[model samples]
Target chain A: MKENIFPAIRLTVICLLFFSGIYTLIVWGVAQFSTNAGKGEIIKQDNKIYYANVGQKFTNDNYFYSRPSAVAYNAAGAGGSNKGPSNPDYLKDVQARIDTFLVHNPGINKSDIPSDLVTASGSGLDPHISVQAANVQVKRIAKIRGIAEGNLQQLIISNTEKPLLGFLGTERINLLKLNIALDNLK
Target chain B: MNTEITGIILMYAAVVAMAIPLGKYIGKVFSNEKTWLDKIFNPADKVFFKLSGINPLKEMNWKQHLVALLTINLIWFLLCMFVLMNMSWLPLNPDSNASMSADLAFNTSISFISNTNLQHYSGETGMSYLGQLVVMLFQFISAGCGIAIAAVVFFAMKETTAGKLGNFYFLFVRSCTRILFPIALVVSILLLFNGVPMTFDGKDPITNLQGDTVQISRGPVAAFVAIKQIGTNGGGFFGPNSAHPLENPSYFTNIIETISLFLIPIAMVFALGYVLKRRKLAWTIFSVMTIGFLLLLIPTVINEMNGNPAIAKMGIAQPMGSMEGKEVRFGSAASAYWAINTTVTSNGSVNAMHDSLTPLSGMNALLGMMVNCFYGGVGVGFLNFYIFIILAVFISGLMVGRTPEFLGKKIEAREMKIAMIIALLHPLLILAGTAIASYLYAHSPVAYAGWLNNPGYHGFSEMLYEFTSSSANNGSGFEGLGDNTPFWNIACGIVMLLARFLPIIGPVSIAGILANKKYIPESAGTLKTDTATFGLMVFAVIAIVAALSFFPALVLGPIAEYFSIY
Candidate 1:
């Protein structure tokens, strides 16, 4: 037992020094060339700074609604609400989201609210919303902002990010970027 | 788009290209023959053996090997539990993260030691630097332990009756030094170059462009991330796992990370062929596993790329498929491929969320883990598959009216009993655990509140996926289950330990016992295991066994969800 135990421990300690120390230093040095020097990509708009990679919350009526967040879009502690369908709390949460969406967009029926709009994204910081999620809220946004529905539709068209190579993820709108564009519109 | 497609093709080509030579190198190292690494590692091996008074030439019986494996694992487990539970006082805790609770510590210690890195907690906020080190240490050791046991079984199959299996200590060390560590170092360095953080600092407070400040947690991410993927240890440095930009920055890193997950396990298969000088048999086995892998990959990619049918009803353009739980950086094709790759190898790291996948895609993930033998984690994958091979050989031998034998050893009733037990144990643990969790959830609704994120069939899948992942020792979660509570922590911990150790014990023990039996040389009348028929038979055994046990649970979960979604 000692034969294997002692040598195993020795090798483990040796590995620890290299894997934890030297290997880490090398990687830290390499991170130097990445977009933010490994500090995450930052976007500066109107004197405010935001991480372009992370999802931002846009709950106002004139802007596109961001995907529901489990952690309320806290990038520092991002995760999904791990509620399965059978759980009453999860069902209630979805129902509550549906109710809230109906209240905001009175023109849309209860069934029209997309799951993406009600259920939270896995990464609570998901920055994009499904094109349906974006479109469903267009009426509410147009009514509040006094913008033409066609103009809002055009804005949606301009803000849409196509799937890579035309067939990867869904066509989606970055709520932060879209709302920024909306705010800029005269 | 052409670049991405070309890149995917190139990655596959590169993995096969690297695996062949790497496999040959591994064969040489383990066979104790002369090799290039002998110059540096030879001295290191000798010095350690000399100090520890271990005879590198001394062989161990299967029982002895098992004991050594268990004892060393127990030691690591204790060390890991202690460190994790005392995280607050530990050094390098720039975040001053509080120590984990007892149940979580138990769950985590068992999870890593078992090589199933099913993390119930997020990385950045949950653990400190020292805690991550402990986890990283276990990742190497756990991965090494798996390969070493496989090496033991490999040697056992080669030796004559009562012949000695190679020393466990030697193989374990070599597995780390010659195999896992070197590759991990290179990959870790590459990831560093690609922008994964390796700093020892705590959370960095960032003032965003919106003037809203958020504290971005940081740690020794690069080193952890490297081994985390390569060792098939998928515990992430951040909560969203590789989905987080820092963990997997660009297409280049994604391809690298994806390749690293399968490289060693695939190489080990080829290594078996090289070592045993049975290239045909090796290829036959490799083909079966790869076919099974690609079979699951096809639908997952299609379903995810097809996007959600429900969304299409709303007249939304879904040019990209279902991007709900996936990142744009890693599109549907890559994410779908990654889902199967990670599950198949027990490398549970995710560039996308498995929980957010369409129902059919989610089933694909569950099925991969349930099958659990497609180029599994470094060493144990081959070990797990060995059980099926034995059964197939025995069954075929019976069909042909001949005595059952494997690699020259007679597959007697004793051997059959062990293999049967090992084979049955996988589904038993998964189904039983899921049944328990589901029954509890069903009977105790209020108590199980917030336990599942999605309701109905998808909810059942979260429970089923959890157990399947645990029992397979592939630690990827459905991610929607509130799994951090005591019930999940303790329950899954038990499942992980049983699932991991029993498979190792059963297969290695069978090899050990068979090693002591009378050797029968292959004759013209002997059943040939290297043929395509034998491969098909083995695949059938895997399918029958997995399907029989998991079909009902799967139907209730992913299949039902699939029908509803469609």
Candidate 2:
């Protein structure tokens, strides 16, 4: 028994190192094995950094915008605040977010708000907004970015992700990737 | 949205079927008696014990040992609960959210503290920063618990008698501070590089097309998500779960999370076998699990990608397969992959809603959580696989007309009976619970029954599935079932205790039995369990045992949909 036990402990250690070594190798492989197709940047403005890939631009043209967040992330603090909408301060914060949006883009009606717009996301640091929210901004984005309105709308349409096997989540557009691409257009 | 209740039930069943072999493979790995792997890590274990101020040389029997281990764990569990309860006053509260309700907090505390990250509320508004730190921190610790338990079991059966059972706090701390944390940190960085956001401040409101101001939400997501997957905590930081663009961010990030989900579970098997000096034995279990994962994931993704003819008839042109509740970035294949990965180990966070999947696809996910999720928790998964090995030795010994011996230890009648009891416990809990719930109570605590939300057989199945999942420490729930009732609450509590301990007791008993056995000399005629042939036998035993226990449940759940899919 004594003979067997010592060997076993020794054996277990080698096994752990070996597997972790392989995992490290595989992870290294994934890091080394990228398609190298696209690249993006995290551009900061007004203390908030949005994802900005190279060759991409933020254009209002034909893109939909999703909901607003009270507490948010940008690559660094990218997680949800886990704050509920029912907090006494929650709605007040939403109103403040609405006011901020008005300062950025003047002249949208309150009724045109996307459901996700006022609602807190599971993760406040979400990179994609609901497609519905994106559509709420399509006309204004189209008018702002100044390409043909239909052409801009087509871009947002192109970015939308359909649900899994046709039925998991609503179609969505990546705010970071789309905004970067939008900048490229202009 | 018309909830496809039947479809969800089907996929749930199928996923369970795939998980059984996974359970076996994981068990076989950590059962090693001695290897180079053990020699290396054992020192660290000793160091940890000494650092924690426990004597490293102390030796205790199984009962005293479990008591110490459980006492330590219970203290940690309480500490975790305390963090959640007091999140409102914590400094990590960048969002400054309120503390969770007592019930909700209890559920969350146990859910994540057990490595079963089932959320009773939306993430964005439910928890404060401190709650996440404590609860999600427990995710790493919980998996460590699984790993440490297996390590203890390993020492128990290992021929060596010297050395501590291992420093529980060290195992917990290292798993978080070393393995899980570093990987999560790197993965989060990569995710950020790939455009996933990470921030502490709120997103500033930006004006949109129709001129309405909308506050775009953002937070410290990348790192949290990275650890969530690594630690096998599927509780979404976002309310919409992983599908939220904020949570998932990019296709690159998606791939990282997918791979991370499988990382520890798969590697543990390698470690287990290597330590046991039976790498091939581990490989066999791995093969069975990987094959099962591929089988379920591939077909589920394919079917979902096929696009629902129902929608096509209306000329809506479903975007290539089961796109409902899936991210456009990931599409069907990725969703299928995520589904398989999550349920492969009882981590049930989905990028897409299982409630909306196809009947067959849904069944696959369900089956994985049920049976194939043998790799359910980090350490527990392998422990289950060990039971299968013992069972295989017993059955095969009868077949070849020789007394069954595993690793030169005789497979006695008592050991066989104990192994068989633990082996069947999961299915028994899952099926019996499902049957009773479906037959007696179909209404969720909150209910409005519509055809889309059938409250009969399908609804009942959902309730049963959720309970089975929770008790089994599998976190995936049939979201359609309002399972927050006292019945579910109490029943699941019992189930969790039983599911976790039954399998553990089996192995502990075996280890005790093995501690007394004398090693027999290997002979040419001795059928070695460490070989490829034995691996296949072990694999067969796991598959057969799972089939026997849950075939009826499958027929009632996922297989029923297989017949229904026209």
Model 2 over residues A68-127: C-alpha lDDT tens digits?
A: 432333222222332211222433555565555555556665545443444433334444
Worst 10 residues of 2 chain B by lDDT: B448-457
Runs in model 1 with CA error above 4 Å?
Answer: A2-12, A29-52, A58-68, A81-121, A126-186, B1-10, B34-40, B43-55, B159-162
What's each prediction's TM-score? Answer: 0.87, 0.72
Root-mean-square deviation of Cα positions for candidate 2 versus the true structure, in angstroms: 10.6
Expressed as tens digits, the lDDT of each residue in B1-566 for candidate 2 is 41132233334444344333433434333332333335545675565444445543445555544555455445555665676778888776766678766666666666775677776665666676546545555666667667766666666545453333443343443444345545666776677556555554544444432244444545555556776787667777766567666566555566567666666676677656655655576677777666666777778867776754333332323343544444445556667767777887777677765654656676677767766444656777778777877887778889999988876667788888888788778887877776666645445433423211333234444555676677557676555455455556556655665776667667876766765677666677677776667767876776676667766766776555445433
Question: DockQ numbers for every candidate?
Answer: 0.23, 0.06
State each model's C-alpha RMSD to the native: 4.1, 10.6
For each candidate, the alpha-carbon lDDT, in order, equals: 0.80, 0.57
> Ignoring the other chain, what TM-score does chain B have in each prediction?
0.98, 0.84
Error of 1 at B353 (Å): 2.0
CAPRI verdict on model 2?
incorrect
